[model samples]
Target: MSRGLLFRLVAIVVVSLVFPLAFTAYGLYSGARVERLALEERERQMQRVLGEVSAGLREINSGGKNGDALDREVRGVLNRTLAGYPGIRGGVFLPETQRTVIGGELKWYDYRPEVWPKEGRELFRERDPVIREALDTGEAVTRRIVMYRGEGLVHALPVTVGGEKAVAWAEEVLQPAIGQDRVLRKWAFLLTTMGFLVALASALYISGSLGRGVNRIKNGLEQLKRDLSYRLPPMPGELGQIVAAINQLAQGLMEKERLEEQLQRSARLAALGHLTAGVAHEMRNPLGIIRGTAQIMAQEYNHVPGLAEDVAVILEQADRQNRVIRELLDFARPAPPLMQEINLNAILESVLSFSRKFLEQNQVNLVTQLSPDLPQVQADGEKIKQVFLNLLLNAVEAMPTGGTITIETLATPDGVAVSFGDTGPGISPEARSHLFDPFYTTKSDGTGLGLAICHQIVTMHGGNIEVETGDRGSVFRVSLPRSPERRDAGGTLDPGD
Candidate 1:
């Protein structure tokens, strides 16, 4: 399976964390190794210096030397040996008399001039432990200590001085690598901490961003399950592309479902057309004959009061039946429209003028918002007027007591549009679905062919009729193309085709 965004995000975080840790580990390891090696080399150098001083002390000639001469000779040996090494100082400690002797010319000594001991007994008292350890053990003892001039190494070796036990000790200031290593360790720790924190912050930020994007996608998918019309919002990088693809897929699915519904509607309408044609042919002749007979009887029996009333009822019923037949025929085989360029606003104004008295009688207030720059469309003015009139009457009937009907004409991208909005109880979802279907009417006395015919006429003219309804009211919009292409020699266009 392909890796998901979660996996990629985790991988990114892991890699981000690993790099700094690896770098820190390597830095610490390399730094410690270098520091250790430098320290070991310094210790070796101090050992060599101490070894040379020890040999030089053994070579000192004290056959007839008095105490002052021996002291001067030993001081000369220490100064000569220590002078050979920069930043090195040496001293001898006699555990028997507790006397310490330091080279006077060695400026690298830890003590200041004021702190320097004038009494030999008080000098090098701190070295007593190390010197005694070396004299007792009869072996060299070495120690590393921090001094005034950085880190230094001190070595004490047991020796026989004037046939008495003593400790010859040497001290040397280590190379500056020891101090540099300390600084390096401090900086490395600080830098590693900072790097780790930065990595953690970056990981959290990236993960949060990715998580939000993924959550959006997830929520979008859930919405799609409930509503195919739902579209994914814009995102960045590859996520944006994914959202675009998903939106396209949703659009395609909606189109496919729309086409399927249209196909079903077309098939049903075709069957109804065939049935309507047969029924209208059968009922038309009978309806005409009945009306003719009723008219003759009424003329002959007017002097008979009750007879005339009965004949009038028969004539009215016949006329109503004939109108029904006529409607069916019109629906079954409608004549093609005479397509021409016409202003929709002019047609709407004409329809409004013709229907004003009827609307006033029904107690409906009329409102108009016709766009001055509305475009003309290719349509039949008379048929378009009929459609608008039917919609207006339907709106008036919807509000039984009284309501407002707003008529609007506006310019669309491809053509002109006219809408009729009415303040009445809206069409239900179930009724709305079949509003344009044959013989489906909400009115008690309606033939249910008015809006269906309107839909058919508009469709023939390469136009569309749509409705939007809510609890507040309903709005019916008719959109006609500016220049519709004639589909056949008869100038008829089938929207489905």
Candidate 2:
């Protein structure tokens, strides 16, 4: 795994855990905060209820109301105060006469002893310290209260009825905070789950993307290692740049290998040329002397019985030796091509005309598909013609019993392409490897310089020659530059046989 991918996965995992937990923690804190605020609001509502009750008691005392009329007025005041604030569930008034006046929505709970706490009912019935403190100090007091049904806030205020202490109280019952907590918990879980799922999916997607990029690069390297010709597909972003670099490296390696092979071949050819130069020089004089001696003997012994055949044999062998020596000399030191613009189709026609009789005698079929608009190539006319002739003769010879030789000419993007396809036994892989090597031959009587010379001529013209062989046949493709400018643009040429 790549470091970047590993780090991203780790980050994703951390976020998946940390963010959700943080959200839950925030929810818990917020829930507590909200409950506190709600409790405070309830306390304020209780205070408001207490304030209204105290004002009503003061008015009743000031008006000198008494008995049933006073009780009715007090009850009406408590009811009106509690009704003004919905949170104030109940209100109780402890008058100087010791009669209790209670009002509000939770008044029924006071009668229902099962749900109401005994201590809470006692506090409302009798004067508790919270109420006593308010009555004794003539001040307001507030307390938080919890019972069976829910929680509440109680407010007690001292009311002076003509300077006599009376307690005015209000209790606000709040909805259960547990329900709010449960809601918060439910939301927290939902949010955390959603956050974690999103994090996991994002992490997988990012990790897989990085892994795929790395794998593609790895696979490309492996392919190039197996076959230098392998090319990478186009990619995007930094990976694309990396892939481009790898492809370039592969290209460089391939070019280097080709150059090394060419250097080795050139070295061998140079050494062979030097050796053949000396050997051919040494053998030529002897071969000429032998031929001259045989001719003299033939002339001197023309009347000698059975001497004619022997002299003829000597002459034939010397001629063969001279041909071999000439081929060597040609291979050792080839003359520079006399560059000129020449029509390749015209030259092919002429060579074909000359080879017609030879091809016919060998029972070989010759087929030419010469292009009509074949562009002229900047090359030595005689050298290019010799290349064509050598290729045709090879094809003719390969098909000993008889086969077809297909010659095709067509225009190419960079130049012109000439293909010579022969229906013959394909060259063996082992022989094909060293087919252009000096003195390498498949035939016993071959000089082996034929294809080498052809390769030489094409190379001098700044062109390429490639051969494809299989069980069916072999195709020799020759690509030549369209003009001198095209050839010269390709830089220097390789010196060859």
Candidate 3:
């Protein structure tokens, strides 16, 4: 979810950044387009100016004046019209004889090298095709004129002065429009860069804040898992509501656990009563044999052969009764634990070492993932070791053939957790509830006090033991409270305090 949030934030930021850049690009395009239209309109105005100059020449020609007078009138029209336009570089009136009739400069070449009066024939034949076409067809034609020094729009119109074919042409410069476009591009680039950086910084800040909020919620959830009594602190908005809901869930779980414990206690008492009656009945037969054997031995000592055989039977039955009594007593009342700071990993290793040969003989593979940095737990070393040993033995027994037993450890907010998993047929739901009951056993020879003792030991150490079973196998998890220095910030196992 956090990843999705980050991606969306980044997507929004990218879109935010792209918009300004795209807008700037559009502005540049629109500006260039407008500039182009304006330049074209200016060229049209220049063409119109040339038209007026051409019309004046035609009017003067209509008078039928001969030689110098008509030439002077056309020359006056060209110079007077050219003076009115700032963009007009120069102009020339080329007569059919390749002579410059009206050159804007005093000397024809003084105006410009590529100006029509200095190189009119070459301009028509090579550079300006539309000009040549206009001269041949006796019509007005326009073309773009580019020289080494500059470029412009050119218009050429065919005319007859005193019955001689002539060409009149004008040029308009475009350097100003090109320079404006360069300036506009630079501004657009600068604006885009600054906008993108601002958007990136803002996105990073917003996304980072969101990530931290999600991490806080995650940490709160872990706290709830590690300590059932823990409640989330107040948070703003929907997050606050989530915290309240989780607290309610914890309360519900606590209530369920309390009720389950009461039910388990009732069930254990009923089972214990039944087991006690059976044990009592079993002990009576052994006790009767011992009593009868003692009386017979006293009456027939040294008088009966093989009387030792009878004595051996009596001793064996006595030992058997003693073992049953001892098991019953241990289950009925367990001794207080001798607490010490012990590493759970070391205890697990010790249990594994003891069971390594047994596992190998039974073809059971063992896997351990003990944390090297696990903190020492304030627990009874022998008792915790016994707990692990019992669980390991049970896992090995669960697998009749070759299988795996995996032991792993992880640090929790309130403590450390160790898990024992067996790849064997899982416990049925009916049997699962009675797995930890004293005197209950799935095995024919088992006294059924092993896991029951383990549960008791872990409970005494201020920890818990839980079991999960499925089709694949079963897992037993033991959560032992950490030492004072390693406990959660809000909790400590300081008996002195």
Candidate 4:
């Protein structure tokens, strides 16, 4: 697995576990802290309550002072408080003596003073330091104790009557501090869960990054398999090194391909050369014999019936064979092209004339829109003539049905333009792509070097030829750069084979 991917997955797992767990722990700890604070507050409030009761009592019952209605109201407040606070451990409230006991022996039990203890405030079990301090001050006592039931806090306050005498005390018990602890537990769990998830997400993200890089490499490889011509994208990091290596491998394969092509071409050319040499050698003797015999028959049968015509046919056949050999030789060892400043218009017109007979034979129409004033282009006139003738002838041949061949020209500051458009079937895409490739031809008896040679000659002239074809037929655009010194808008010239 890639490092990024590994990091992401591990991060996911870790977050899944750590967030919930740590949140729970933190929640628990916080809950405990809140619980303690709540307990402390409860104790302080208890102390305040006690002080209020005791002070109220002392105002009325100080120095053993008492009142009947005050006793009734005090009893009512105690009853209500005890009822509201179920956790409270009840204690005496006096309006006569200023004494508040948080935890102590009751002055009376079962309707009578029982188990009364001296200094009852000190006698109670002290559970918290604040409560002890409150008692010593004779103000109030707030403390926690497990005297009668479950753990609880005590709040007590002193009361005085008149101006200077202690009167009574009020005491109340509060619930324990543990309830708030539960909330903390929940919070801690939440925080831990969030933290864990964050970590896990990070890991997952890293892993995905790694996986993405690998996927790119895989896709690049697949595309290479489909099209060897396609180049792969540059990979990142060490993977870049891998891509570089793959590129090297592809280059090696391309070299091998070139070598194979060269080998195949060489092999075919060798076979063709051998066959042509042998055939030409073999036919030469027969051709010479036939020529000599034809001459003798022409002379001897001059006054004979129609033997002269027969002799002529024989001679023509022999000569045609010899011409075919000459064509082969021309293909094998072509003459070097001689370059000159030739007018394209004349060349195009000459080809048109040559194919004019064919065009007439096929009942095809010929049209010319040659530029009025064209520049003389530097080229091998003979080869340019051949290119023009071949193309015109092909166009004429294509439209066995009567059609028009249109030739046009355009002159520009940059170059000379000649356009040949034929109202025949347009060039097929598959064949057009390789039209200039040697041996790639649509016609059955075609040597297939015509367009290739045209391309070579045009290129030699420092020009380019382009073709566009569709349902509207085919058009060839030939562009030749204008000569440096000699410039003519467009003009005419005589061209020949």
Candidate 5:
């Protein structure tokens, strides 16, 4: 199964979103685990400190100390033990007297010494349950709590001092860890936001590019519907390949349509040729008799002014009709070209020489760009000359007022091409469609067989003729293969009219 553009884009978006989310979740989870481990280790350290303090109290009480001396000894032990641990405070709680003795530098009371007793009482009250639990169970207890400064850990150990049950406790402020955790959270949030933004940007860019490519294809298809010659421009990646394929398909369809039209035209011309052959043959005998009778009358009535002129008119019309009959017969059954290898340039030069007087008389300026390296082609030299001559005459006729006729010859991959460019009013689309049809002419006196004969001659020679017209003028190009053998061996000519 193939996935469409939508499916691929959706998958990309999903993956982009998921990867960052997964990474963020993992980072948070890992940070939390590390925090938990650090807290656990701190709790263990606090428990060890309480145990040492409790042992010191027992040793002091065993020395027969009591009252203020006993309290002093206990304070000395706590201060000595807790001095090594910064942010830690240790104390002993007497359940019977409801007394609390705190140790260490007591820096927590730097600002307000009078509130020490009150703050101590409140601290004791908060830990009263853990202290009682330790005294009753005779086991150590640990708890995590949030104090005025920040989060911290507390541990309590029960011991017998002077035959009285007492609780020894120590706490370490976890302000540093708390600060670190807050910073970690901020960084995580920042990274996650950045990742999400990057993902969003990437998705948007990809989607936009895809949309443009799709729209180009869509618009190109719409244009193709309206005009078969329309083609999509080149693109990049997969879309470029698609555009190339579409253009190729459009070209093929255009070619196919042209071939169909050509086939229809060929069929129509074949039928017309048969009919014209029969008609011309039937008219030939009567036409000959009329011309001969008119010639005799012209001679005999030479002395008669009006009769001689009338006979001359008859003779002229008869000759014109005879010429028409000959052209019709030629179109009806064209003779096969006497093929031979010939230089196209030489033929062009010959025709130009023959038509120089005619071109000059018509005020036509001829410009020739014949290629010296133009290859010879296998064709009838006389017929090829005729084709060139006919094209030159047509150009001269198109530009009645003085204009330029540019003739160029260039070598092709398989053969040679000759183009005749004329400055004229340009052929209209309506006339261009049937420009080579038999008996189709734009001029009042034209039999329309000139271009029709040209088409038949070029086609029989395994070549093609094409015309390009615009406001500038018209360019008629004729291309012939290097040899008939090459043309027969799958060599194809470009399509034209």
Candidate 6:
């Protein structure tokens, strides 16, 4: 089945069983929780009300508390309570006599003095155990068959009524005619219906999504196996994240494939360089022999030596070829660096200062535009210095007659930025691309390892280096991230917009 249909099926089954069962169960449990909390709150409220009542009644009955003023307050309690729970059926207030002092018009009610339950003969009592416990503990006592037509809760409290300490008791009973329980049940049903619909919708969404996700992953993997180049296109919501992960995985695979291809190409290049080196070595011996033999022949046949100049030229050209081969071998492999944190600014200043005299003699003005708050980037300063020096040397060499060399420090969002511009001849578009290649150079006498080593240095420092050739001259830009910031950097150099 399709995931959307299966989800709907599961939801239908769950909804069929859960709603009626939970609703009925809730009806049984809700009343108990409410009753417990409400009953406790009611008991606390009653205790507070009765304390003042006891004190006032005592004063009124004995002329001891508040000088008869308490009598009015005692009457107020009777009047207020009748208004509060009018269905209270009625109660009696007694100060001295054990007889009930019924409230206004209370005698006409079925609730009478005869209805108050009392202990029988043979009971060892100053008062009934239930009343005594309630009075002594200052707590309510619940007893069976003690009051009118339901569960009755009684509280007995001590008072100084009629200048003698007496006990006052009060009772309340829960009646079934209020219809509150029915209203409560109706709300409970309505709440259950709403909750059921919400949960059903959520579950439907989740189940369908889960099934769809699993299918997408399965299909994606099948496609990936057949075509490793396949990419996971973006989707909506969390499935978008799944697609992102798939894309990331696909990208990683692609990078690995690219690395493998590079390695294969490197192997091919290594073989070719080795073969060329061997051929050069073999030719070196023969060329040396031929040059030596030709020189000897020219010396001996000087009388008929029209061919001496050509042989000498051949010898010189062979010497030049030998030198080029030697350079190529040297550049084929480079040594690992002694890496350490060193200031590039210091290195640049030192190298430029050292080369300053030679540059000035040739009318080449060396400009220093170091950053005021240039951060100390971690790098092998010696290697980086060699790179800057080589570029400078190359620029001077390129600008044979004379020109201006502008060196500047820059701060970039990506990292620390450095730029070098020379008023040398502009590089051709073709030669600029291969400028950093091992044996690539525009100058005939140049070794060509200079820019290549410079590239290696900047890359090792986790920075990038690039060159821009324009109408003026060539510019090399370097970017590097400043080291992790410290707690409170003292006046940081912000890369202001």
Give the TM-score of each candidate: 0.64, 0.56, 0.50, 0.43, 0.63, 0.36
How does model 2 fare in lDDT?
A: 0.76
lDDT of model number 1: 0.77
| Residue 378, model 4: Cα distance from true site in angstroms | 9.6
Question: Which candidate would rank higher by lDDT, 3 or 5?
Answer: 5
C-alpha lDDT of all candidate models, in order? 0.77, 0.76, 0.72, 0.61, 0.78, 0.61
Minimal lDDT window, size 10, model 6: 488-497
Worst 10 residues of 4 by lDDT: 488-497
RMSD of 3: 10.0
Give the number of the best model, judged by lDDT: 5
Distance from true position, residue 271, model 4, in Å? Answer: 4.8
Q: List model 6 lDDT by residue over 1-497, tens digit each.
A: 34666667676858685968586667747765676666666455555545655655655544455523443444455555545544332233333444333333233432223553442122113225655565467555543234433354454566555565445544455445323574667677777677777777777777777777767777887988766677766678887888889889888997797557435534544554566556656777877888788788888888885678877788898788777665444334334446656666887888977898888888888887988777677666676777788888887887888998889996677557888889988787668656765557766777676776576556556665777786679988877666532221111111111
Note each model's CA RMSD in angstroms.
Answer: 8.5, 12.7, 10.0, 14.1, 11.7, 19.2
Candidate 1 lDDT by residue in tens digits, 214-306: 889989999998777789999989889999999999999988986676566677777777777887888888888888888888888778769
**Candidate scoring better on TM-score of 2 and 4:** 2
CA shift of 10, model 4, Å: 5.3
Q: Flag regions of model 2 displaced more than 4 Å.
A: 1-188, 259-267, 285-322, 352-371, 392-408, 412-414, 420-433, 442-446, 466-476, 483-497
Provide the lDDT at 147 for model 2.
45
Score candidate 2 by TM-score against the native. 0.56
| Candidate 1 steric clashes | 0
Per-candidate total of colliding backbone pairs: 0, 0, 0, 50, 0, 1
Off by over 4 Å in 6: 1-330, 481-497
Alpha carbon lDDT at 217, candidate 2: 88
Least accurate 10 contiguous residues by lDDT in model 5: 488-497
lDDT, candidate 1, at 145: 62
